[model samples]
Target: MDEWLKAGLDYVPRWIDYQVQHFAQPGCAIAVAHQGEVVLEAAFGTADLSTGEALTPRHRFRVASHSKTFTAAGILKLKERGLLRLDDGVGNFVPGLHPDIASVTVQQLLSHSGGLVRDGADAGQFTNHRPFLSTAELKADLVLAPPYGAAERFKYSNHGYGLLGLIIEAVTGEPYTTWIMREIVRAAGLTETAADIGLMTGGTLARGHSTRLPLGRRLVIPGDNLTNDVASATGFVSTAGDLVRFFSQLSPMSEAGLLSPLSRRDMTRGHWPDSESVLDRSYGLGIISGTLKGWDWFGHSGSFPGTLSRTAVFPAQGLAISVLTNAIDGPAQLWVDGIAQILKAFHAGGAPHEEVADWVGRWWMLWGAVDLVPIGGKVFASPTALTPPLAEMSEIQVTGRDAGKVIRASGFFSPGEAVARLRDGRGEVSEIRLGGTRLVSQSAFADELVARYQGFSKDRA
Candidate 1:
């Protein structure tokens, strides 16, 4: 194994130990890949606490919403074949489905900008319990309201995704699930992964168990079958390995043979600004765009009964990570770090070993007022305004590989505040500082003067 892989493997025991201490999770599965090669595929803990079936690399788990990327890719593949345009409005596909939804477009649906309410059914609606609604049925039953506006903004709408799935069925002349299997799944060669909603009732399925009490007394009940039939927006189960394989294609220079270069870029292009200042990180079609650890990555998070999953791919570093837990409340935060650390160790050689002067710069957050500016090649942070006596600093660090660099700093300046860091991607000294007191910092210090003030924008990753 390569040194990075060795390092990643070394951390597994530590991760397992940590999970045991923090969450008491039964078991966890993690997959990490770099430059199209999976260096680490290990499972720690138990797939079933009672049975003591040790989690293994071959184990499968429901990747919940992580299925969104596959479904979105299926829709985009149809677009690639001249079947539909994202700009095509929702009404065009689902004719007369909703009179109020005549103005919503497919792009809006993908980005969750469509003004569809989050849940169509009230709490007591599904009380006694019933079979899940089909895709078209879901669209009709759940889509109760109209778009808030024509402009796209981020508002997670499951109904919007359901509508997207419905459109897929209409355009492909097949059930949404069937079309996805033939076009995206088959094309991607994911034979083992599918929307197996009722796997528990059938053979060759992993039993899903919840960590907490059964909700509505329907615990351990078979998942709704509608989940698979109408999977365009949600509803798909996959293995960590297969998910890593599917998402590996999304990296900028990947060779996964799933998406063409043009298609990959098209999928990543920021279709709509998610918020005010973050131009780089936004939603496009069905994918979320952003940077992590200094690498431009794209993917989504998924959640369902007894499942929570997240998959991310760092394009510049040519790395991807996927984690799936059968438990309802998995170690989500630690899981992300575990994969990040794995990627960092595997691709450590590729990461910048020596700091560069150009790496020092200022960054502005998309939502916060903190500005990270480079001064004298060292790092300094000013909370409200960039002025003198800007507390010298402590524990400064920079992370993220080439093209996606962030500066992090901890201690003193902003007590109780998360260590501040410079945001990634932009060339100038402007960066968005995440996790600190949002005390509206103003850029009053002169740029040149700040540069000579012995403080660069400390990376607070």
Candidate 2:
């Protein structure tokens, strides 16, 4: 790895720790792949909060909606084999009675442009109010009129995908889960992935945590509610590592992968804008394509009850990253973006500017130590829990001898505080204080505290 890459990799663990600890998440897992190899894998916090079980990398998460990507691949695989075409109408093979729903082409279903109902009107199963739909229930839901006409606009439909699973069964004469596991998943080198909960055996599945409501805590439980035919739509389980590996192969740059270059390009190329509000996001066949940090990327996000996930593949960088969280409101997207930021900063980080040379030091107080670093004349607070890392030391004009007011600090409650570098008789910095939180030199911290106590005692008398 290049120095920047190495530096970025080294920082990943610390960042994960910071996010899990400070953000009040149950825990999260991450996997990053560069040039087709897994580089960093980590798990932080407890997987099973009730039992206080620490999460491990091997734990599986209910990668809901990511199943769409796999199912889409199966459809494409069939197309490649000349069994079906993207333009084939759903009504032909499945023998459906609804002309409107049947008239929709296969491609539209894959791209979520089929205008099918997203979830049945009674989707209480998702909220655990009722059991998940069976094949018969799914069929009953499919007969309902679509919310809109075909190719009307981008409309996400789990029902659309569940129909595709029926079509897959019609064409292949086998179960959707079995066919996909044999063809798409196993072929892609994922031994840990499964289509639904029942299929998930032998390994530990990451217990899905409940969402922290307005004033509630997240708890661990079974998050995979989608079963039976719906498994093809929103039911899948995977590790962050497997997710990255699978998406990396979807990049056209891969010499040999699950799909042909033509198929990969067709799948990643944006077909329709995701919404009127989103300019950068669009849907391809089973894939969500968007831009990050100005680089085009394509992948999918999974949102189970207690899990949130996001994956992105930057073909230019030959890189893929996946962040999986067992909590209901995991910052998977932000953390994924944060990783990209780290990589970007590492490459941008060069020699420090002259103005920052004097600012480099470890200042301390009773609370903890704060390391001031100047980068290219700009000071940044590193990641810390105690105080905001002085991210940007703006308006650094001196206020007094051996003391200056840091007009800005980065942590909560530390900003706009008077930061003074107190000097000893020898003109050395004895300690520093950001507001009332006195941070002393390491060697002098205890003595400084003792002296302050003694002085306070005398003043009281």
Go through the candidates in order and give the C-alpha RMSD of each one to the true structure: 14.3, 6.0
Q: What is the lDDT of residue 279 in candidate 1?
A: 39
Error of 2 at 177 (Å): 0.8
Each model's lDDT: 0.59, 0.79
Please give the clash total of every predicted structure, in order. 30, 9
* Per-prediction TM-score: 0.68, 0.81
* Candidate 1 per-residue lDDT over residues 366-451, each given as its tens digit: 22223232332333343312111122332234443223222444543443334433333873333334344322222533444466
* Model 2, global lDDT: 0.79
| Superposed Cα RMSD, model 2 | 6.0
**Per-residue lDDT of 117 in model 1:** 65
Q: After superposing candidate 1, which stretches have Cα over 4 Å from the reference?
A: 123-130, 198-204, 211-229, 272-281, 345-461
